[model samples]
Target chain A: GAGVSQSPSNKVTEKGKDVELRCDPISGHTALYWYRQSLGQGLEFLIYFQGNSAPDKSGLPSDRFSAERTGGSVSTLTIQRTQQEDSAVYLCASSFAGGNSPLHFGNGTRLTVT
Target chain B: LAKTTQPISMDSYEGQEVNITCSHNNIATNDYITWYQQFPSQGPRFIIQGYKTKVTNEVASLFIPADRKSSTLSLPRVSLSDTAVYYCLVGDEPISSGSARQLTFGSGTQLTVLP
Candidate 1:
């Protein structure tokens, strides 16, 4: 099966504007994750979703950042009133969430807030 | 989750075997070490994983000492294409309770393969 897929390989928006990043996890994968990678930095955990279980939002940086996984498959990450600091590569990953399966990641959407 | 520390960067010449070590001094008994590789503009790709002793795949080899506090990723005969950032992560594999956790990556080590 194909790996995780994320749309809008690149996105540019004004600092005060809002933006949405989408992720389509691998078919049949029960767990999904979103991470942020700033230039020359490590991957920062953002949010995670596991089946019908409540999504974990503890990693989200601020109220302006939110995410939702619809139908337990596709997910959308929205950033409101974006700040320049929000500029980074947003990566989406998915796995079986059991037996210590490794995560498969998408190419990611590079968000640049001007 | 255990914290991992790796060298900020390393330089090697093409065709040389490179070994990058990661330190997780506080690793737990249940923790398993995994390594990932990332090229520019691409998401990370899993390389190798191991609990103790040695584990090898077509891509790389993982060596963990009995102490379990550290692990090393060894690239065999690296090439220019092997230049990338390598990350090491230590996580409690999976408990019998069917619980799972997110993987935490450190500021990976950047490997430059020079010709």
Candidate 2:
């Protein structure tokens, strides 16, 4: 792909339902990141993948949230028992390492929990 | 973490030069200043970056002070297309504290370029 790609550009789910978002990073990129943006707010760090494994998940807001990357290229973010507060845009980005490299972002998935 | 402060918004006319300044009073010696531009409903795009002094590219110029506590992103002869939210980010490797090159975004300055 030409850039980072995210699935389900938009998602609306009922409270308590589980939802999953997917991201496919730019080919050969070694770093991937996930962030959340609430209404009129700045991007909040969620989780990131150094390759196929996440070195840090401290940004995950709660135990209801989890993520995984496979084959060092694709990632999935899963949220369980969704609550209204879970509504926000989920953005995925990729970079090349200490990579001082600029991040390439996906259009993002706007998840709306009802 | 190195924190940055920037104007909330700015208005400019097409064809004029636009300068957005950011203040990071406690910036680290290894920190690098970076700028990103985002249009409505889209992901932000990297504009330019600098570690010190001045750095120029085909799109913009980054000017950092000797103290490295502040930096400015200069867009020459702006156009309406330049209207967007401009973010100032300061960091080194591991873009954020979480451990990757995660560029943290501040409450960017909204630049409105009028034609």
Candidate 3:
């Protein structure tokens, strides 16, 4: 719609449960990004999509973390076997393809691993 | 991507002009300086961006010098609602880093506008 949108504004999961967070980027935007922010901390890059392809996946914190984007519009970030340390606000952002294009961010999904 | 350095925190009173500066000593020729502001419980909002000289928008102004090593974000007539964390980011391509390095906005300056 008008801006980047994220699903389940808040999510609480058990330690071993899996969770998926979805993002709908601004229409026609070719770049999407995922970032995590712990309480009182700066943002940590997770992964990004140039269209539906993620050029790199090494930024993921662990093997259990994965992300995918489809239709160059919607993207999902999945966390497996959640840990207490995984609790943080997961943010999604989108911008035009260029590097200098400013990103439009969504209100993040605050994931709490209990 | 160019690494950015900024202060940890700053304080200003209402109606005062506030300038937060960011230093990027190794900024590349293609790098552009961008600024973002975030409040508690919300995502960051773009403030302004610049390559050199000055850029002004309804919300703020970005001033970059000739050398491009440093840039400043100037907020005019601050108010309590302007209290937030401001980040300075310098980068070329968002996804071009591949697996080598990740784009980052370093610990930002926490600006508190006292009423």
Candidate 4:
């Protein structure tokens, strides 16, 4: 794909339900990252994957939040037993395998837990 | 990760120039300074990235000092549509053995271009 793509642009779920957000990175990109932004807040780093291996997962908020990237192209973030405070925009970005490469971001999925 | 600090908000009028500054006192030698602009319901878009003194692109210009402790993003001829949150990010390098690009974002500066 030309740009990063995220699925379910908007999601509304009950407090205890589970939600999954998908992200498809650009073609040939080897680095994928997930970030969360609360209402009127800065972007919070969630996880980072280089190829199919996640080198960093320290930023995941809690045990309920987990993510996996398959084939080094697509990634999924799952939140189990979501809470009301989990309502936010989940942004996905992908970059080439270097430090100088700028990350291209997707439009993000807005999750609302009622 | 190098911590960054920027202004909370800024106000500018149309046709005026806006300059937002970011301070990163603990920036590493290999760290690169990058700026991103985000609108109300969209993802952040890259504005400029600079590693040294200065870099200018079509959209914005980034000015870094000799010490590399602080940088400024210059937006020329601002308009109402230029109102957005600007994030200054440092540390695009690999900190550990197999770390990918790690970007630490602070509360960005909100620039409002008034008509």
Q: Which pairs of residues clash in candidate 2, taking residues 3 or more apart in a chain or in different chains?
A: B95-B101
Model 3 clash count equals 0
TM-score of each: 0.94, 0.95, 0.96, 0.97
List pairs with backbone clashes in candidate 4.
Answer: none
Task: Extract clashing residue pairs from model 3.
Answer: none
Q: lDDT of candidate 2?
A: 0.88
Give a tens-digit lDDT track for model 2, residues A1-114. Answer: 599999989999999999999999999898898989887777787887888778778789999999999999999999999999999999999988774788888989999998
Which stretches in model 2 have alpha-carbon errors above 4 Å? Answer: B95-98
Give lDDT for model 4. 0.92
Residue lDDT tens for model 3, B3-64: 88999999999999999999999998877888999999999999898889999999999999
TM-score between candidate 4 and the true structure = 0.97
DockQ of each: 0.54, 0.58, 0.64, 0.63
- Candidate 4 lDDT, A3-93, residue by residue in tens: 8999999999999999999999999998889999999999999999988989888889999999999998999999999999999999999
**Among all candidates shown, the one with the greatest DockQ:** 3
**lDDT against the true structure, each candidate:** 0.88, 0.88, 0.90, 0.92
Q: Which docking class does model 4 fall in? A: medium
lDDT of 3 by residue, A3-112 (tens): 88999999999999999999999999998999999999989888888889988666799999999999899999999999999999999999998657898999999999
| Model 2 chain A worst lDDT run, 10 consecutive residues | A96-105
Question: What's the true lDDT of residue A43 in model 4?
Answer: 96
Give the distance in Å from residue B98's predicted Cα in candidate 1 to where it truly belongs. 9.6
How well is each residue in A6-73 modelled by candidate 1, as lDDT tens digits?
Answer: 99999999999999999999999888889999998999988778874534667889999999888989
